[model samples]
Every structure is written in C-alpha cells, then in structure tokens.
Target: LEAYQKFVFEEDRLRSVQIAHHICSLMQRGNVVVRWKLYHSVFNPVLQRGVKLAHHCQHSSVTSAQMHSCPHHDQCLPQEVLQVYLKTLPALLKS
Candidate 1:
C-alpha cells in the first residue's frame, strides 16, 4: 500500500510538471484561449471563494468590501492582506 501511494504521488508530481510545461509553451505562443481558460477555470474560482468567505465574516459597518479594518490593527484586514495579495499579480504570474 505504501509503495502504491508513493507511486501515485510521483505520478501526480510528474503530471503537474508536464502541465506546467505545457502551459508555459502555450504562454510563449501567446495563446489567449489557454491563458484565459487557466485563469477563469482554475484561478478565478479560487479567488472568488476566498473573497466570499472574507466578506461573510465582515461587520456590516465595515463600509468597504474586503477593506474592513481588523480589530487588532488600525488598518482594514482586507485592505492590508487580501487587497495586497490581489495586487501582487506579477508575483503570482511568476509562480
């Protein structure tokens, strides 16, 4: 069972590498369809879910969407972290 699990994990890792390489090639070729599909199908949903969760716990008086201030810090939690994360698109693209 352990060997089988290891094999499966290795297979998954190889597949991930292959997928990344294929995506890189598509990017080099300037394939908008492939890039958009990767973002809309994969990345956008993940970001939307996280943003939804952030909004759900926010106080009504917070005013700004995800910009609600964290109680511990003077600045809004959303503005400080989530917005910052969203702004770092170049870093994400690098990954």
Candidate 2:
C-alpha cells in the first residue's frame, strides 16, 4: 500500500511538471485568448496536481522529513521562462 501510494504520487508529480513546461512553451507562441484558454484549461489542473503532490508529501511518513529533497520539488517551469510569461501576462490580459 505504501509503495503504491508513493508511486502514484511520483507519477502525478512528474505529469504535472511536464504540463507546467508545456504551458510555458504554449505561452511563448500563443496569442492572448489562446494563452487565456490554455491557462484556464491546462494550467489550473497542473496547479491542482502540484497542490495535491505537496499535500501528499507532507502527509507521507517516508517523505515528510525529506520534502525539500525531492527532485520534482524544483522541476516546474524555469525562472527565465516564468519571468517572460509574467512580463507578457499583463499585456495579454489587457487585450
């Protein structure tokens, strides 16, 4: 039971990380409405998954103490990509 739970947690975390990266890529090329839709459709779910992963890590006895050591903890979108996205978000929202 513990092993399976850990596996599922890791799987979800990896998938969420991939989605985060994809969202950044889409933001780089898509227009305002497209980005807006993608944010609502895709990014929200990834955010939820991240929240779930964090909760799981916090609750899991095997991981509670080592939460910060998890590789996936830092696997989300890169800083530069996120900065670019933030810079464009205001312009996109205005349009």
Candidate 3:
C-alpha cells in the first residue's frame, strides 16, 4: 500500500486505472472496506477515462491467439493501432 501511495502522492502521478485496479485486486484479496471504497468512488471514473482515450484508438475487434498490445494507451496521440484496454476487458481482473 505504501508503494502505491508513493507512486501516487509522492510522485504526483495520477495513474487512475492502475490505482483503481490495485484497489480492486485488494478487494478480491478480501478487504471489505477497500471493496466498498472502490465500488463507491474509483471504478466508474477509471472506466470513463478509458472510454475517452478509446476515442483516439481503433477499438479493435480482430480475433487472434496473440492480440495487439498498446503500451501508450494512456496518451492521446493518434496511432496506427492503439488498443484501449479497460477494466471491463473479459477477465482482466481475474486471478
């Protein structure tokens, strides 16, 4: 938790998706309060951010055993193939 806090607060970084996913992962690890806070405050906003960024992306629908990976989905510059992976991605949060 302290490492996450450092990456967020100390570094003045707002990695909303990572932070939200981490909190969700903690919830999956069985923390009632963290789950409550994530559902109440964090989840939707991160998805919204992904949706906004997806506009600049292609919204891929291709089927392949190994799919495309976009490293810079967090940015807004146009690219040939920008995969906007979000929280709702099939079983992303599954362990």
Residue range with the least summed lDDT across 10 consecutive positions in model 1:
1-10
Q: In model 1, what is the error at residue 82, expressed in angstroms?
A: 7.8
Can you write out model 2's per-residue Cα lDDT over 1-95, one digit (the tens) per residue? 22322332243545534444555667667887877676766544445555556565666643544655666555433333334335555654565
Sorting all predicted structures by lDDT, with the top scorer first, yields 2, 1, 3
Model 2 ranges off by over 4 Å: 1-20, 64-95
Best by TM-score: 2
With candidate 3 superimposed using the best TM-score fit, by how many Å does residue 13's alpha carbon deviate from the native?
Answer: 7.4
Predictions in order: lDDT: 0.42, 0.51, 0.42
TM-score of each: 0.33, 0.44, 0.38
lDDT pick, better of 1 and 2: 2
Q: List ranges where model 3 is wrong by over 4 Å.
A: 1-21, 31-33, 58-95
lDDT of 1 by residue, 5-83 (tens): 2222232445534443443344445566755665555335435644664564564434454333535322212232333
Report the error of model 3 at residue 30, Å.
Answer: 3.7
Please write out the lDDT profile of model 3 over residues 1-95, one tens digit for every residue: 44443332222234533454456566566566765565445444445544555543545542232123544433431221112224333433553
